[model samples]
Target: MMQRRTLAAGVAAFSALWLAAPLATAAVETPDALVKRLSADILETIKADPELRNGNIARISQVVDNTVMPHVNFRRMTSAAVGPQWRQATPAQRERLQQEFKLMLIRTYAGALKQVSDQRVVVKPLRAAPEDKDVLVRTEVHGKGEPVQLDFRLENTDGKGWKIYNLNVLGVWMVETYRTQFAQELNKGGIDGLINALASRTIAADAKTAKSAQP
Candidate 1:
């Protein structure tokens, strides 16, 4: 409860992390180990950098690009959010959707990475078979109040290490939530409509970020 509000207000964005993994070569990073290390690194990076703590949009974008984007499985995340319409989308549209969605998240949460002073991530032991390719890792974010539950759904490729495609916070899965909204937009107009909606939100968020940055 308070953790969500605190994070949404301050912004660690485990929500964004669910969407934050991409192509990886052969690595032996286990899901829980990755979460523990990634979480620690992110917190340290934010607290150590003054500009990031101050919420400079440009700096935040740079950090996200260099640090987080590499680990995100963008296609799996975007396509799942787009639902069945994903297969119908052309390559260009798919690219646009992914771009806008990326911006929406960066603009929404990445910029606030600085306010993570008290939040500490505790990843629970992962439960899965040795042969499993897809698995969930449970975690908690401890802050001002009761610890909030966070979960990650990760998939592994033969050569690639674990990549996160979805995230859950406070009992809500981000993809499932976005899918419903995207479906509504799809019904109203189509893929274009959904893209437009995401674009509009991203644009508005950009404007808000700019204004905030203005001192």
Candidate 2:
């Protein structure tokens, strides 16, 4: 369970690096090229920024909100994580789920990305065809340890270009992992119960992150 949580944290952090791209280059760049460009760009920016490196949770959340949230199809991610219960969730419940999930990811991102050191992300050659709507972009984080495999599952929309909806971090699919957990919550407590549970976790996580970020 601890190991699973660790891998999920990797998903959260790398999801930020890959999704928090430099605005919308979606129209001009192909998905692989987009990943390549954004991965290097975000990492370099983090390496250069002192506050980001030091895990200022507020600053990290702000950066992620400004750069990461816009690019990701997080509504779809939340839907998938919620499984079939998503369709049954009322508008308010869905909205709450989205907000809590995003907050949890931002807090998770603070801890995960802070582990970045002298690492550089190298995107492997992409194999998908030009017109492919759904594709995977594979990459490896090369640094002190062995190269960690991180793959992105993305969808290309008409005007939205490419949006990441799922992440494969070290062989674990983030959405599926969360789906299993969320299903447990839904079974035990239903929609409101799930939302409340997510809210509680995110609040606790944020408080812990905030306490650790102190001087």
lDDT minimum window of 10 residues, candidate 2: 4-13
Query: Local distance difference test, per candidate?
Result: 0.75, 0.76
Query: In model 1, where do residues sit more than 4 Å from their true spots?
Result: 1-27, 111-114, 213-215
Model 2 / residue 119 / CA error / Å: 1.2
Q: Each prediction's TM-score against the native?
A: 0.88, 0.88
Q: Candidate 2 on 40-128: residue-level lDDT in tens?
A: 77777777777876767678777777777655789999999999989999999999999888877766666566565566678888898
Residue 90, model 2, lDDT: 94
Candidate with the greatest TM-score versus the true structure:
2
Model 2 regions lying over 4 Å from their true place: 1-19, 23-26, 210-215
Each model's total of backbone clashes? 7, 0
lDDT, candidate 2, residue 34?
A: 74
lDDT of 1 by residue, 1-215 (tens): 66547546334647334223333436678878887777766666666777776766677677667767656687899999899999999999999999888878766665556546767888898898888889999988877766777888988876467777888877889899889889999999898998999999988987876777676
